[model samples]
Target: SCHPECNGICAQNMDSTSCTDPQTQYCSPYEYNSTSQSCNFEPTCVDNCDLCYNTIECQDCSPGYYLTPSKLCSETCPTGYYPNGEVCEKCHSDCSECTGPSDSDCTACVDPKRTPVSGICECSEGYFENSGV
Candidate 1:
């Protein structure tokens, strides 16, 4: 039997009452509004999200964007973090930009007084390391 809300068309399983197909029936930008029992054209996903279950649950990102663990789409990773495939990974504390998580993977230094030397951030000639007092 078809769901009463869907009229004569079955949105999902014939025995079920909710619409789960967001691709065909509702398209990517629309979502099934259970309360109204209708498809609504809403911005239910993040800006750069290509696919999502809802605003807070992004499944994939659009081109030139990456998906964060928090289910958000980002164009670029924040400082102290680097892009790893489709996700952002934390960099070493001393690195402003790095290829990996280790300090030795540093491509840039967070401090102007320090410089990247052999993939590591080291104190420059006119600077000295602080004891963190």
Candidate 2:
């Protein structure tokens, strides 16, 4: 008889109903037959094993600061700011220190002592302060 059978159905010819496994949902184990009641196999998820996006990068932490678990860029301590290794920290007033990202690392004057109102960016560690005309 032309009944919806597991072994074969009229799907191709316009009479067979689509057959699939109840668990996996894949086509029945065997092709649609005349009188089968069960599909033999199940469908499964195939891991693509995708890779990370190229845009994402692992930048280094800013100076005076340490990298966190979530690899992100951070600013370093400035003249006044002091990071406790983990993060940049604010220095006491009057103390001139530097802070900010390594790229634009900041170095500002704290309280107590006044910053050279004029050309204060004159001295470095090893070099003496340059007196510009």
- TM-score: which candidate is best? 1
- Alpha-carbon shift of residue 6 in model 1 (angstroms): 22
lDDT of 1: 0.70
| Per-model CA lDDT versus the true structure | 0.70, 0.35
Each prediction's Cα RMSD?
8.2, 19.9
Tens digit of per-residue lDDT, candidate 2, span 20-51: 32233223222323355333232221122111
TM-score of each: 0.57, 0.22
lDDT for model 2, on a 0 to 1 scale? 0.35
Steric clash pairs (candidate 1): none
Q: Show where candidate 2 strays beyond 4 Å.
A: 1-72, 98-133
* Weakest lDDT window of 10 consecutive positions for candidate 1: 1-10
Residues 1-133 of candidate 1 have per-residue lDDT tens digits of 2333434234453333553443334333445565665556655777888776556656778888877767788998776778888878889998998888899989899888889999899998988888999
